[model samples]
Target chain A: MYWEKEIETMDREQLERLQAVRLRETLERAKKSVHYGKRFAEMGLDIGGIRTDADVEKLPLTTKDDLRENWPYGFLACSRDELIRMHSSSGTTGRATVIFHTTRDIGAWTNLLARCMYMAGMRRSDVFQNMMTYGLFTGGLGFHYGAEKIGALVIPAGAGNSKRQIQLMRDFETTAIHIIPSYALHLSTVFTEVGVDPRRDTKLRLAFLGAEPHSEKMRRKIEDLYGFRAFNSYGLSEMNGPGMAFECPEQDGMHIWEDNYIVEIIDPMTLKPVPDGEEGELVTTTLLREGMPILRYRTMDLTRIIPGPCPCGRTHRRIERIKGRTDDMMILKGVNIFPIQIEKKLMEIPGVGTNFVIILDRADYNDSMTVKVEVQKEFFGGDLRQLEALRRRIVEELKSDILITPRVDLVEPDSLPQSEGKAKRVIDNRKD
Target chain B: MISYQLSIFAENKPGRLAAVTRVLAKEKINIRATTISTSDTFGVIHLIVDDPARAEDALTKAGMTVSLSRVLAVVIPDQPGGLDRLTQLLLTENVNINNAYGFVLEGHRKAVFVVSVDQIEKAEALLEKNGFQTLDAEALSAIEPFHYMKY
Candidate 1:
């Protein structure tokens, strides 16, 4: 009944035993790398002493900075000849973090993604349309191989041709799509403008949304608008792009596949593990990978492990939706704020559209925040008073939630700059 | 009775008005009069055009949020007291005007004052009862503004 029923449904005791064995193997492979070899030698890490999953705490946490400091092949465990392909982070800020994969590593990643897609109800008969751009970014190829492994007819329609995307949906009877949440919402408008109601015209019933952290309300809005069930997917390039954790049919939380990786949530300040059900940073260690096996890699994504067993019977532990990244947290007036907080509040309001941007500036030693939201066309009745009321309502709601009064600005529909990839939601103009 | 005016939602940015005019120009739609009112970050452009329905369609197809609203186009004498007389009647009757724009058809002879109000039928009835000559869409669009001027 499952992709790998034996592994997927392995009990906790058996899973821990399997993880202990894989942990030792992963450490042995990690030791072959130049970066981890010196660190392990310095810490005198005894691979034999690591007997259980809890023993992962002994390993020093690997960070993005460490990956950048090492540069290209510092983390490659296997010989250069064994490498098949490599994916790198966009490196918009600093040095790009790169990860190499052997043929076997690619196979393991493909199987893991297949398991995830199957768990989300994708089938062999389904025609999957992958709308993500395939490049150094892992989202496109990772899911593409996985969907193909499931025997689904894969239509690799890369991002940003709303008219062509709709035409493909109609022509191919595309039953499923892998898209970012923002692009999914943006495509819904095109469906109407092109006079094709997806609910009636296309056979699309399933969508896989990932690559960007989105709210539950945003998920529901996409589902309601497109008349499909959108499954939230969580993954990073360090952990092989998008098959890290995925929502089962229950939709309670995503189950992190523990067979291939060990997951830990830790306090960012203390760098210590937080108990299950408490929010903290996600640290992961990859097993079953040959080319580059990361040990205790700090993900910087904030989420908590959902305690208790999921009704889907997958013994793997579940994780809550990623709240926000540690680096993306905005500190204003001695208070912490996240763009998702404003986005969540705006989604609940009736007249608010799918697009918004948060601008930060400072004047007279005071930091100020301004949220610009697009006014929905249906709600704009050519009345100034109604628009003013909507703006005031957004400000009040945002203040009540974020604990600071923010200046709200309403703009024309689709006026904000939109990217084909993850939406750029913040613009910081303050000179720090 | 009531004439239609195209109201467009726009951002307060450079070249936005040019973009709007480009759309209308491509469609060969003539603008009778136009008024733009801006708030902090956005503005609304209200246009009295020759064919409001066609203008709205063209602007919307060009990806602008355009809405057609019912407005009253009242004919008044092209004199200083012409608009004052209309305002006095509206003030006494408590008929609030949300947006208004005017242009003289013939200098010192006649002018058109376009006013957008919430209660269109009531405003129209009150204006007619007050002996005010209100123009419908056809008459307002057909007005020959500055036709009496010779260069």
Candidate 2:
């Protein structure tokens, strides 16, 4: 039964052949995008000359700085044929990154997203209310298209309108949800405020969350909200948004759609590939995308890709949940701080919510970072002393790790805006 | 009736007022009259100036956060008992008078009392209810043109 699927059970040789065939077409298509056209020329390689995966990696890795240098449309590798649509990535720290998707690319994404839903045992009879904000952005459209393609009735109940989202769930008998992990807790709050028991009133069985790195603690919270199993979906808008990979019912790790995108882990400093179980930066290549095919695009997200058998029986490569971003490190007093580390420390605090902000500033020629947090009410009911204790603990942990002291502020739950799509983490207060 | 107002932040140092004036002098901004309510560390300086906005901006850029507020200018009886009546009414209203000062209309013999209050609208309302008079922005500007002139 495990070896039933031909593509899933394909030998390494067959998989290599599949990747090479797709690479050839993607390269030919890449030449049309303005960004890649000049890049391929400068690289001194023709689309037809490239033969294998090594040939693809030998070209060069495209960084965010390179994308910034080209700006807006510098790296479009496709035109009319592969250029079906374009959208922007959330740019909280700097300029927004844009993503282009061909019609075929869109179909492949929906197919993968459908496979994700299937792995979780979601059926066409299930109703899903996607809570992503619709715009010239991939997050909302990615889930919306995928849900519809899977033949599930989807409500484009964009984020923040919790009142209607809840009503829609009750009225439509919504069985599944596709939204940011944070918003799911907000739903529980609305349910309680409206005097409805989530486990009692509605039929929410599964939740698919993406667009931000959430803690395992948050996954448990969402699961407890409606007695539904919550799964994490991972993707960047540059790589066709939210459908890139998702967790199966087993919840071991996210399954990377290797048939379409080649995922690799490389040491960010040395730029050399790391073996399985070693944490490194996630670099992705579009094995099948026609419009604007990315060749070793550095995602800046750090994770370990574990290649092996999944209980779900999908041959897709599994990536251990993200460690954090290397480029987007929060520097405090010459020390590198990451939001995921903050999340880990925060999750241990009983009352703390998953959201936190690293307030950045310049003081006396050194960076001063303050961690401001919000506590959940069930864990902390407006107790100032308890908040103070948590703050002291956080300061101690941050100090021990960064070797610099920081001020920690505890705020009320839901103090930070429940992000509609992208979560804001770093706050630069030097100017404001 | 006349009123003059100036906004200053609540930061304290011995030469803080001097710093404010020095910036005013460099910018050619004139000060007509001034009073500062100071605690151990914070000061709220309510002064009459040629330009309030520009002066506020200069002070903000210079690292002093300031907020502009309106004060009431009332015509007192020009007698000692006249001042007592207003302050007593204010005490009854529970409004702290942060600062107070005035100038005499030399020709008219009218003594104008310029009073700053924590609650401007309520203090003005109580004064108006008690049959006192006040000045609008234009009239206040005429007395303190240095304030209405922005930059």
- Model 2 residue runs over 4 Å out of place are A1-4, A46-49, A91-94, A329-432, B1-151
Candidate 2: residue A221 Cα off by (Å): 1.4
Backbone clashes in each candidate structure, one number apiece? Answer: 0, 10
Candidate 2 local lDDT, residue B31: 70
lDDT of 1 by residue, A1-432 (tens): 489999999999999999999999999999999999999999988888998999899999999888988888898898999999998763122234788999999999999899989988999999999998787778889999999999999999977788999999889999999987767777888888889998889999999988777678879988888889999998888888789999999999999999989999999999999999999999999988889999998888999999999888899999999886777656454344667678888999988877999998866434689999998887777766677788899999888777679999988788887634688888877542
- Which candidate's TM-score is highest? 2
- In the range A31-66, model 2's lDDT, one tens digit per residue, is 776777887789787677788866765767888677
Clashing pairs in 2: A33-A76, A33-A77, A33-A78, A34-A76, A35-A74, A35-A75, B49-B146, B50-B146, B50-B147, B51-B146
Ten consecutive residues with minimal summed lDDT in candidate 2 chain A? Answer: A377-386
Q: Evaluate all candidate structures by whole-model CA lDDT and list the values in order.
A: 0.85, 0.70
